[model samples]
Target: MKADVIDAEHASRVTKVDSLLPEIPVLNADDVQLVGDPELITVSVGDSAGSGLATCRSVPEDSPRSSWQALTEHRLELKLAGPEPVAAISALLDQWEVHLANVARKSDIETAAVIARPSRDTIGSAELLQHGFAPVVGIAVRPAERLATTGPVTTPGVRIRPAELGDLPTAVHLQLELQRYDAQFGMTTMRAGAEEMVTEELRAQLSGEPTMWIAELYGQPLGMVRVQLPDQAFWISSCVNAARVGYLSSLAVAEPARSSGVGTALANHAHQVLEEAGAEVMLLHHALASPQSTPFWYAQGYRPLWTFWQRRPAVR
Candidate 1:
C-alpha cells in the first residue's frame, strides 16, 4: 500500500471526537504525506466540534525500517479542545495503538511508535518520555515596559545601538541563556539542537523583518532586546486600537552584570526603539510563577491581560 490515510471527514468516530472538542481542528491527512515511509502515523486531535478535525496517517507495513523510527523522527501534534476532549482523545489514542499493533504484527513489522501531544495535565519529562513524546514547547511573552524601571537600578552606561551581524552570536547566546534560566520553572527547555535554531533566527533578524538592539557595558554584551513591527492579524488588531506596542522578545543580563542596571538600560533602549517605530505601548508574556520576572514586570506597570493553564495526568 502506498500509505493508509484516515481523515476527519471519512471516519464517523473521528467526527465524534470533533463534536466533543470543538476548539480542536481536524487534521488534513494530505499534510501528513510530507514525511516519507516507513513513517509514524501522525494523529492530531484538534479542539473543535464540527469546527475541528482529528487525523491519523499510518505508515506502510512492509517498509524497510522500524515504525518506531518513523514516529520519533517526524513532528506529531495533538490538541485537546478542553478537559472533556483531553480525556476522550487520550482514550482514543490508546485504542489506536491497539489497532496499529495488530496491523503491524500481521504485516511482520516490528518496532512501532505512536507520539501524541501531551494533555495540559502532563507532569514531567519522565512521564512524557515514557509515552515516547516530549513536553510541549510554549512561547513566553513579557511586556516591554514592565522591565522599564523594575529590578535593581543601575547607572546607565553605553547608549543603545542597533545590532549588527557581528553581534548575532552574542545576542543568540543571550537568548539561549535566558531560555536556560526559564527551564528551572518547568518552562520549555531550549537545550538540544537549540544552538542551530538560534543561529538561524539571528540570521533572519540580520536579513530584516525586525530590529535587534544590544546594551553593552565596558564594551561587552550586557543585555539585548528585539522589537518587531506589527505584521500579523493580532498585531494589526493591537495597532488599530493605537496599542502602539513594542515586544520585548528577549532580555537578559549576565550573572555578573545583574543588579548593575543592565536590564533597565536595555529596557530603556527598547522603549526608545518602540517610540521611534510609532509604538505607544509594549507587550510581553512571562510565566505567572516566575520569581525573578513576574514581580519585576508587575513593578514596572505591566499587568496580566491573559492567562494560560496546563494540566496532565499525575501518573505520567
Candidate 2:
C-alpha cells in the first residue's frame, strides 16, 4: 500500500495491491479412475446368452462399472478366436477388483461372486483367490465309470431303495431339512415361507420327475438322495458330452444317520444306479461349509472344477 499526501496536508489517499493465486492441479478422468480396458465378465461383451447363473449375487442394469472387456459369465467358455482376453495378468486382476467394487457400489449388491471352471485359458483357482475372492462352494464331478469301485457296498441292516409316492409326506419334511441345511451355510437366502415353498417343489420332484432314493435302516427312513438325468445344461458339462449326466440334485441325512456312512452309501448307490442306466458322469454341488459336504465328496473322487466365491459388503 502507498499513501500520497496533498498540499492541504489534511487527507491522505491509500492504494491497495492484490497478489496472484497459487496454481492447483486438477484431477483428470484417467488419473482418477481404474485401468483402461478392464477384463469384464459380463453378458455385454462376448456371448451374452448363457453366462450361467451367479450364485451369491445378482447383476442388474445401472451398475457403476463404466469400463471393462467382458469375460465368460457362465458355462466355462474359452474362445481363442476373439480379441485378446487378457494382455497382462497382474493388470487385469487389478481391474477385476475395481470392477467388483464398482458393481457392488452401483448395483447396491450385498455380495459379488463369480464361477471358475476348467479351461485352457483362465484365471486358475489359486489366482482367483489371490484377487480377493474366496471359494464358498464347489461343483464336484466324477465319471460314472468310477462308481464300480465305490459302489454296491451293502451296509448290513441298511437298504437303499427307490422312493415311492407313498413316501411323499415324510420326504417333503426331509426336504425342509435340506433347504434349512443349505441356508445354514449362507449358500441361499432364508426366505419367508420357505417351508411351504419347498414343500410344493419337493412334491413335484417326487411325482415321477426325479428318481428319489431313500436310505432305510430296516424300513426306517434314515437319509435320501435324488438322482436325475439333467434335462438342461447344468453349467458344468463333461457329463453332457457323455450324453447322459447323473445329477445328484438333493441329499439329506437324518440327524441320527450322518457320518454313519449312510450318506456315502447313498451317493455310491445313486452313482451305481445311474451308471446302470448308462449315465457316464456323476455331478453334485456341495456347500463349502454347510451340509458337511466337502470332505465326503472329495473322498468319493469328485474333484471341483468350479468354485463359487462370495463376500458380502455393506449396501451403499
Candidate 3:
C-alpha cells in the first residue's frame, strides 16, 4: 500500500515542515525497496489519515549500513502530509512496529532510523524530537567561495598534497582514528572488523570517486581530507540541483596533530581544490553529539541543513 495521495497534493491536514525545503516529502511506497524478504517490506496508506508514507527495513548484523546504529537494526523512513501530521504520523509509526513484529522476531530489530532531509522549517525537526527522535547525524552545507581562503595552518614543514596509492596505510589509519573519535560521542559503536571495513572502503574511495588529500608535517602523515564531486544520492534535497556540490566525505587528524592547525590546513586545501573543479557548494555530515564537530564545521562556514533522527524500542 502507498500513501493515498502522492506528493502530499491534498495534505490539508498536514502542514509543510520546512517551507524553504526544495521539494515536498512525496516519496510514495514505490520510492524505496528493501534487500530482505519482499514480504517484510509492507506499505499502507490507502485513505489513511496521514498523507505521508511509512516504510521499514530490517537490517541484519552484517549489513554494511547497519554499523552506525549498533544497538538498533530497524530503519524507518517517514513523511506525513495531511492535517494533524504529528498525531497522524505517530499513529502510523505505532502500526508499523506491529507490522514488523508479525514478520520478524523483535530481537533482530531494536531501533527505528529515519533520515530527515534538509529543510527550512522546524516543524518536522521539532516534532520528531518530541516523539523520541534524537538527532544523531547532521548534514551541513556552505558555498565554495566562503570556503576558499588563505591557509589557516601554514607553518614551517607542513604540506598538503593529493593522496596516492602509497598513502593507503596512513590513510586507512587516519580514517579509523576519525571513526574512533566519533565513537567517543556515540556516533557509532566500535564493531569488530571495523578496521578491515575502513581499509576496504578507503582503498576503493582512494581509487575512485573521492579525491583524497594528505597533510604531512616533516614527512610524517598526520592527517587527510576526502572530497567527492556531487552525487545525487547524497543530495536528499532535490531543490539543491542548481549548483555543483563538492562533498567533504571525511577529515582526519591524528591526536598529536590536532592543535597545530592541521585540520584547518586540510580544509582550506580541499576548498581550493573543489573550487578549481567548479564546485559551487560544499557538503558533509556529522554527529551532533560530538563537541569538536559542532564548532569546527561552523567555523568553516557550514550550518546544519538536515538531521537524521532515530528511535529504539524494545521488542513489541
The prediction achieving the highest lDDT against the true structure is 3
Q: Which regions of candidate 2 fall more than 4 Å away from where they truly are? A: 1-89, 100-111, 119-127, 146-151, 230-241, 313-316
lDDT by residue (88-190, candidate 1, tens digit) is 3454445444544443333221222333321222422343344444332222223334434453344556556678898888887887787777755544334
Worst 10 residues of 2 by lDDT: 13-22
- Best-to-worst order by lDDT is 3, 2, 1
Clashes found in each candidate (C-alpha, N, C closer than 3 A): 27, 7, 7
1 versus 3: better TM-score goes to: 3
lDDT agreement with native, every candidate: 0.47, 0.51, 0.63
- Candidate 3 lDDT by residue in tens digits, 182-213: 87665665667877877787788777754899
The count of residue-pair clashes in candidate 3 stands at 7
Which ten residues in a row are the worst by lDDT in model 3?
A: 24-33
Candidate 1 lands at a TM-score of: 0.51
Candidate 3 regions off by >4 Å? 1-20, 24-49, 58-66, 69-75, 81-84, 100-104, 107-111, 115-119, 124-127, 146-157, 208-210, 231-241, 313-316
Pick the winner on TM-score between candidates 2 and 3: 3
Q: Residue 22 error for model 2, in Å?
A: 62
Over the full model, what C-alpha lDDT does candidate 2 score relative to the true structure? 0.51
Winner by TM-score: 3
